[model samples]
Target: MYNLVRFLQKHHFFILFVFLEVLALSMLSRSHHYQRASINHRTNNLAASIYHLQSHISDYFSLRYQNTILQKQNAELLHKLALAHLPEPQPDSILKERLVDYIPARVINNTVNLRNNYIIINKGYRDGVARDMGLISADGVAGIIIGVSEHYATAMSLLHQHSVLSIRFLKNDQIANLHWRGGNYRQAEVVDIPSHVIPQQGDSLVTSGHSFVFPEGIMVGTVDEVMESEKGNLNSARVRFSTDFGKLRYVYVVKNVYQNELDGLAKIKTNE
Candidate 1:
């Protein structure tokens, strides 16, 4: 108490000034209507200004979140664009065409430097994410879901050793199996392409949509190598993957809303 009194004595003049300022402000707020109105307006303006400043800061920090939304929107729009350019489904088709569902997800963990690496995403069952869904980025397809937990899932990257995506050449449009040799990080193999089509290096390839895993026309990559398969029946080539798994920050998991129906119809056709 003695120390407090000593400190107050040392700064008494400044304290008095502050106390007088507070009392003046209080009087203005309580006395004259015009003064009170002015005070209220000024206070409101200050509050609004602070809120506006805070909003700008919040938006600045949320750019990444906003980008995730935009990326998902882009994926949805691109999927629709690809379908729009495609021919109508067959008259006897069982499943409806041109309708694909998309679940936006962020790549929480990714690795491209190692062979047989898997990617982890920031979505799971709660978000309707499930195993076997096709995962892709804006530049191109990434991989397929192979494992799932309650709130997380893992994907077999396009560069994984056992990864296989039904793909085809874009120029001559020869169907083949896309695989990785588990060595190269940026390269994929397109096997069983008939040599009659004259496969060329740098030929663009995309998803064949022959299976239930991925829809048609998702960009995979360009042909990086062309050679005769060991079996020698058909030509084989290596495709430089479109998405660089090492640099991935965000991606989308494709959910086919009518997948069950489509898969059933596809199975029926294959059996026949």
Candidate 2:
């Protein structure tokens, strides 16, 4: 207290000068039109800058909420799209209802730099997520569920060496198997496309609906390059995966309604 008093006494003259200067400015601003206008403009600018800073901070924190909302919206759109693309009812056949259902999930854990990459989602049997369920992102097919807990599930990512998905050429409907080479996260190899199929660069491919994991016509990727096998009977393609694994935040797990019936028949055939 004593030091503060002495310091103030020593600078009293300078302090008084500053105080009078501020008082004069205040009076001038109130009395003169131009000074008042300038002061108002400065005040308005300061308020606007503070508001902008507040808004920016709010948006930064709300990003996760916004992403979750987008994921749910995408799940709804995917459900509708799957139903719309169902094959037209045959002339004498009854159309099946509810062929597919989508469960929205957030990716809680993921890795791309592994020999067999896996994705862990915040959904499990409790959320109707199960093994063999297909996972997809907003852009394309993401993975297939391989393990499930009560409240979480693990999926085999498209980047996994053992991950294989049956895909078909969008142009010619030629079927092939997609497998990853385990180095580049963005590229996969398409095998079993016969040489006679003639795939070009940028040819689009989609799920074939053979395994019932994914709906037919879900995009896989585009052909980046093609090479003829040494045997000259088959062609392989380097597919640029549509789903960016590094940026995956949310995914949809697709459950096929008729999967049980299909699995029963397959088990019987295997036993026989």
As for candidate 1, its clashing pairs are none
**lDDT (Cα) of model 2:** 0.80
Which 10-residue span in candidate 2 carries the lowest summed lDDT?
Answer: 34-43
Clash total of candidate 2: 0
83 in model 1: Cα distance from truth in Å? 12
lDDT of 1 at 133: 82
Model 1: which ten-residue window has the lowest total lDDT?
Answer: 34-43
Indicate which candidate wins on TM-score: 2
Model 1, backbone clash pairs (residues 3+ apart or across chains), number = 0
lDDT of 2 by residue, 122-229 (tens): 677898987778999877999988767666677778886557789999999999999998889999998788988879999999999998889999989999998878
Q: For each candidate in the order shown, give its overall lDDT on alpha carbons.
A: 0.74, 0.80
RMSD of 1: 20.8
